[model samples]
Target: METALIEYGNFLVAGVTVNATESTDFAAVWDELLERVSDEQKTATAKLQKVGVLMPDAADEGFTYTAGFIVQGIPAVAALGLTGVVVPAAMYATVLVEGPAADSIKPGFEYLHSTFIPEKDVTPTGVNLEVYGPGDVTASNYRMYCWSAVDGVESPI
Candidate 1:
């Protein structure tokens, strides 16, 4: 996976959050979230995109992940029984992954952390963002953007 360094503005998102450990079933977590947050909620947004925000724990054991929708402004998140997040504006090392989500996401992430960041001499902020399209995710050729926020870019493309 090749990475491109790009800057993005702050994004407002609201959805259900989960404390994800190694044992957590991500598919089930996403399923439950999608169940509670309707299609209307997910689509009625400023940016028509769904995102998975991963914030690593202080000890690096697990992550607090939010399955969310990019919204326009202050939303009534509590009324919908959801949590809101303001993804800060920053420079990101991004990779476009195309394949089954199960087969692609983890390996792409590993490549970024273990190879790209280290080789490029960039410092990770420990915030990873997954931008998903409104398509058949279970399909073999699902597409998504995986972004890792970094402090500095050794080389920007």
Candidate 2:
């Protein structure tokens, strides 16, 4: 498969999330977070939007990730203030991950970091974004778009 380096201008999002060292049970966790969002909708300052992902340092330390984004354009601070969740505001280079949500995209990510990126002489710049769309319809129907920024790529005009 071929991969391209591109830029995402900006986005505004908010939600709740958790972090786990063991591979996460995303389905159950996402559902629970959504429930919290639904119940708190009336008091929320920003709209609850889509789900996302953040990679931890290779060491996999405790509470290394976060969930939620605020309404005031607070860069990467999650609105819910979960222990590890923070919002990220920076340019990113993304790729679409199709197929099962479990490990289907691992190879792609490996290839991007190991092969494509080095060949292009670029370093990772911003947060890696995992954009979840309608594909979460079923256990096997999961689809997520993964993105990472070129170390020195500039913001779009």
Best by lDDT: 1
lDDT of 2 by residue, 53-124 (tens): 565554556433334443445433344433233445555555666677556556656777787777777787
How high is each candidate's TM-score? 0.83, 0.61
Report the Cα lDDT for residue 42, model 2. Answer: 33
lDDT of 1 by residue, 72-157 (tens): 67646654566788888888888888887877888878888898878868899978988886577778888888899998764344
Cα-based lDDT for every prediction:
0.78, 0.55
- Model 2 gets an lDDT of 0.55
Regions of model 1 farther than 4 Å from truth = 39-47, 57-62, 76-79, 154-157
